[model samples]
Target chain A: GAGVSQTPSNKVTEKGKYVELRCDPISGHTALYWYRQSLGQGPEFLIYFQGTGAADDSGLPNDRFFAVRPEGSVSTLKIQRTERGDSAVYLCASSLGGGRRPYEQYFGPGTRLTVT
Target chain B: GQQVMQIPQYQHVQEGEDFTTYCNSSTTLSNIQWYKQRPGGHPVFLIQLVKSGEVKKQKRLTFQFGEAKKNSSLHITATQTTDVGTYFCAGEGGGTSYGKLTFGQGTILTVHP
Candidate 1:
């Protein structure tokens, strides 16, 4: 079976431009997550989706950052008026959700977004 | 908000040496997961510890959960060049945030052969 995957391995855009990063989760995975990682740091939680609804979006930095999993399989992270500080690796992960405890997560290759 | 803190942001060891990284969380965690990421790759799941004061081993790697469920550690014996990468500890709050993970700053390990 194929693992999780993300498109646009690399993206460079102007600081004020809008950008969308896509993620395709593994088949049958009910839980999807989005995280942002800065250089020399750990991944920061951005949002999480169970089915078509976002279970947690508290990690989103601001209103400019939004994500949606319309079909409950693929997710798109949108950034409006991207800033240089938003330059980082955007990672997506998926797992078997709806358990007493959380399950292990399988991560994607990630999309490196560089705001120039 | 929960925060996971890792110790020794960077470590350098010889191929045959031992390496260890510790993680502490601001709040009690239901479970802790370890992940390894190569220099240019994404994170790969290593292990998960759920029980308090639990210990699990995989080959030369050993993972231990704290007695309080708020801390954990990962130790590698006889480090190999293949172990060169960043190690991250992710904590799950286990309540309404069950699927959401709070990750540590990560520990970067470099092994010289």
Candidate 2:
């Protein structure tokens, strides 16, 4: 089966420009998550979605970051007025949700966003 | 806010040497998952520890969950060059926010063959 997939393996954009990154979760995976990994650092949680609604968005850094998972499958992370600090590898993961035990996450190749 | 801290930001080991990385969480975790990411690659899940004081092994890798469920460790015996990568420990709060994972800083392991 195909694992999670993300679009635009690399994206370079000017600062202050808006950018959107897309993710396609594994088939039948109800839980999807977004994370940002800067060089030499761990992945920072951005948002999580269960079904079509965001289950957790507290990890989002600020109002400039927003994500949507319409139809409970594909998700898009939108960054408005991107800053140099926003440059990082955007990772998307998915797992089988709705169980007492947490399921392991399958990650995508990630989209590296560079704000120039 | 929950945070997962990993120790020894970086480590270097000989091909036949042993390597280990430790992880600690500010809050109690319901489960901890380990992931390995090769250079220039995405993270791949390794294993998950759920029970307190539980230990799981996969070939040369050994994973241990602390009795307090706030810490964990991953050990690799007789390391090989294939072990060169970053290891991450992700903790799940296990409440209403069970799906959201708090990841550790990650430990970069380099193996000299």
Candidate 3:
């Protein structure tokens, strides 16, 4: 089975420009999550989706960061007015269940976003 | 807000030596998961622990969840070059917050032959 995957392995954009990153979760996975990883740091949670609705989004840094999982299988993280601080590896993951406790998550290769 | 902290941000060991990383949470966690990420790669799930004072092993790797549910540890016996990577511990807060995971800083392990 194909694992989770993201598009645009690398993206370089000018600061203040808008950008969108896509994620394709594994088949039959109902729980999808987005995280950001900075250099020399662990992944920071960004948002989570259960089905077509966002189950948790407290991790989103600000209103400039938004994500949507319209079909419950694929998701997109959108950034408005990107900043240099937003430059990092954007990771996407999915689990078999709807984020039940102790469920293992499969991760995607990630999209490295560089705001120049 | 919950925070997960990991100690010994980096570890260097020779082959056949042992390596360990510790994770602590300010709040009690409903479950904890461990992940490994090789350089220039995405994170891969290794294991998850939900029970208090639980211990699980995968060949040379050992994982332990504290009785308090606020701490965890990963220990590797007889380290191999293949084990060189970053180990991260992520915890899910108790209650209805099932999808959000608070990740620790992570520990980078380097094994020399």
Candidate 4:
């Protein structure tokens, strides 16, 4: 079975530019989540999706951060007008069933986005 | 607004020494999960504890959930250099706040052989 996978393991872009990070969840996983991890800190929740709709997006820092899971299997995190503070590793995770329980989440290698 | 605080932000131990990290949450958690992330790697799930006052063990690692369900601890006995990494405890949101996990600040463990 394939674990979660993310594209563009490393991305460096100018501040104010737009960047999109993609994630491919594990097969049969219905719960998907995106998180951001800054250096020397823990992961911060960004958004969550169950099926094709986002169930919890309160973790998103601002309006510039948006995510979508169109088909329920893949997700994309879009950052508009990226700021230098947006530099961090973007992590995507997925679990079986909806996110009602604390099921073990499978994490991807992550896309390190650096806003220069 | 839930927060999970982890302590001993950083630790260094001998190859055969023991190590422990504690996680405390501001709110009562429905369940807690532990993850290990190696340097330059992503987090890997280790275990999950759902019952109050429950303890689970995996090899040399022991995980305990507090009776109040607001805290948890992970202890590794006789750790090896391979154990060098960061350990994080994530608390699952209860009530209508499902689908999101509040992760601790994480404890970085360094082991010398």
Arranged by lDDT, best first: 1, 3, 2, 4
A best-first ranking of the candidates according to their DockQ comes to 4, 3, 1, 2
| Candidate 3: docking tier | high
Ten residues in sequence with the least summed lDDT for candidate 2 chain A: A96-105
**DockQ of candidate 1, scored on C-alphas against the true complex (2 decimals):** 0.79
Clash statistics: count for each candidate: 0, 0, 0, 0
1 against 4, candidate with superior lDDT: 1
> What level of docking quality does candidate 1 show?
medium
TM-score of 2: 0.97
List of clashing residue pairs for candidate 2: none
CA-lDDT, candidates in order:
0.95, 0.94, 0.94, 0.93
Better of 3 and 4 by lDDT: 3
Alpha carbon deviation, residue B31, candidate 1 (Å) = 0.3
The fraction of reference A/B contacts recovered in model 3 reads 0.84
Clashing pairs in 1: none
**List of chain B TM-scores, one per candidate:** 0.99, 0.98, 0.98, 0.98
* lDDT, residue B104, candidate 4: 93
Task: Give the range where candidate 3 chain A is weakest over 10 consecutive residues by summed lDDT.
Answer: A96-105
Error of 1 at B70 (Å): 0.8
lDDT of 3 by residue, A1-116 (tens): 89999998999999999999999999999999999999999999999898999988998999999999988899999999999999999999999875565578899999999999
- Residue A10, model 4: Cα distance from true site in angstroms: 0.8
Worst 10 residues of 1 chain B by lDDT: B93-102
lDDT of 4 by residue, A45-79 (tens): 99889999999999999999999988889999999
